[model samples]
Target: MRTAATILDFQHVTKKFGKTIAVNDVTFQVKEGEVYGLLGPNGAGKTTVIKSIVGHLRPSSGSITISSYDLQKEFADAIDFVGAVVEYPMHYEYMSGYQNLKLTANMYPEVTKARIEEVIELVGLQGRIDEPVRKYSLGMRQRLALAQSILNYPQLLILDEPMNGLDPLGMRDLRNLLRSLAANGMSILVSSHILEEMELMCDRIGIMSHGYMIAERNMDEIHHAQTPVYLVRVNDPEEALKLLSEEYGEQLHAKEAVGGRIEVETTLISASQINRILIKAGIEVQEIHEKKQSLEELYLQLTGGAEIE
Candidate 1:
């Protein structure tokens, strides 16, 4: 498989606030044309990382490079290829959304009128594009802020809680829009407290806890690496349970069968092996399937069962 180019690189990055360490010796990279998520609970240093990337706060000790330009050394040039929405939407409440975008475009000499219109449509803000920002709903304002961020057609986009104020339909629309942008080669790094949404939206996720990065893995890796558990259906629940218990010993975890179905928790055994054993023992097999672990389950396990702050 061909490797994607690295668009954002954070090498041994650390951020400190006096006696408090916000981010500690963290290292990660975001590749081109992929949606990367920083998944963490509140106070997990996610916002600090986002702020450092956008040049709002400098890392105490580390190197940050965006599109091959060192952020500290070449702030202007590096930021030219980057755009971000650090937190809540900030806009001129009295100005129309269209005017807000137009003013933002004026800051970039290359931003055109057509590009402004295109982003408004892309973010589904065309209906309220002419309305004053103060009159817009929270979700609409968020969308407008997103549109402004992309007005310059950045190579890298960093969003801090991009889905914060969106409704269900609004979240769905944002997901689709982000997918389209990534398909067109825009690298994205987004932070979110919503686990399920991150599971669906991100190509890969980095889990952070308390100020440290605990793990980073793609969805498939998370799914396959968790201890395998399955729900099984058989003719003789007692026999299957007894046989499985005997064969696997302590590795077997048999739950009470409900309606002739049994739940087994084991990592060393596969569905096929379970089925074969039951059939060989004259236990009729009605249905058998593997139960995939939810992202929440894996996340809990990785974080030592600590509640998300």
Candidate 2:
């Protein structure tokens, strides 16, 4: 569970490029020790929100607070406990990974050799921490970037598209790393188009559409929101379907016969409830099982079939 303290707050924040509104009246908070994800299709302003937090693009209106420090008024103080990696993480290709980290360490105060080594090990790059970054694979580079972001032991970590170029194994590694960090008390705000990964990684997710926040939900809420599909074996399939259809109207989908069973899809009624409804209607149900929908299905439904770019 996250502490009530707000690590990051966007209070009615809005951003505009001339007449174009990039972010509109967005307000949310990332609680302490939570991994909050910003999810949307491309051009939905996920990147714009992230950029505003890191102070790259100033919000056109409203305010942003980081650990209670006003971002606009106290820029340095607000960003003191913040670390971020946005878009492509640039590094000196010619420099060894250790040397690159050494250069970056010069910019922040109190970052020591021990901290650098710890972050390197934390990102699983101890074996190749001394290699030239140019020779490293994309996954390895992403790991290195992650190491850099946390080298200062920031209280808040911001990541934009952190899993952009990773393979399956790399994505898994990144997810594990993030979970480990969050457990250690780091609050992370991440933006990504990867719904499945977000579903797996995030504690809570805020969805966006057309630069507007459409919905926000925690992991458990998302899980319970998945419309349940029930497979039922009854004494009479055709009669049960007719009874359910007539009783429930369009709310139930009791169709498609499979052997002696009928697969029913419904959002409002559970398998047990459906079974009870049939039993009360004088239909004997032999078995009932609920099928869970994948995160992709839920995402599409929530976004109204708006494809994630």
Candidate 3:
């Protein structure tokens, strides 16, 4: 893709706070109309990476580009099409929600009051639009934060822990809202501890750990796994087990039926050879398919069983 075609790109980007490398030489690309998830445990360089991309923190080395604007050389132009909420993104507590949105809009040269009201309504805060932000709940604040971010109709929206303090209903609404925004050609980078939500919301996901991008995958790659597992389903499992023991017992794993199917994880065996062996033993292979692992399982396997932080 040309530089302008890519909404965001981090090439060998590294960020350091003193001697601590918060974000290592990370590289990733986000295309337009895609919600790219930056998922990781706490202290996994997630926040640092987001901060670097959105102009809060500069990378110590390497490069980050937003469309045709180089982050280092064209900071203002790079940020021109970007709008974000870095953290809690608190507005004036004493001000009404409408007032807060108005002030935010006023920061832009040509932003009008009507545009402010439009964004507030879009975020579903219209009923309480005149209420003070201090009285707003966590979910309300999040909604307002989103409203502020979209006031510019940003080409790239970077939200850090956007679902931080939202209820289930709010999270669901936010997911739908983000999907709609992406459909409108806005690229988004959302970093949140909500892995399940990310799994549902994002078109692609990148896992970060120990200041490095551990994995990046599209929906299909993230969801459907091609793990080298053999799922053995047979009419006579006892006979089938015995036949397997007589032949390839060493590669066998957890020889038990679960959910009406016998599962085995092994060093990828050939489907034709398995069929031939089963036919020769007269084991009546009802269904013998490869078992694919889920994203959650793959995550645990790769991350040394670390908990989401």
TM of each candidate vs. truth: 0.80, 0.79, 0.80
The best-first sequence of candidates by lDDT reads 1, 2, 3
> Which ranges of candidate 3 are over 4 A from the true structure?
1-4, 224-228, 231-290
Each model's C-alpha lDDT? Answer: 0.88, 0.88, 0.84
Tens digits of per-residue lDDT, candidate 2, 129-235, equal 88999999877888888899998888999999899879898789889989988998899999998888899999999988778988887898667765677889999
CA displacement after TM-score superposition, residue 140 of candidate 2 (Å):
2.2
Evaluated against the true structure, the overall lDDT of model 3 is 0.84
230-279: candidate 1 lDDT, tens digit per residue: 88988788888888888877877887556888888887778888888889
Lowest-sum lDDT 10-residue window in model 2: 290-299
What range of 10 consecutive residues in model 1 has the weakest lDDT sum?
Answer: 300-309
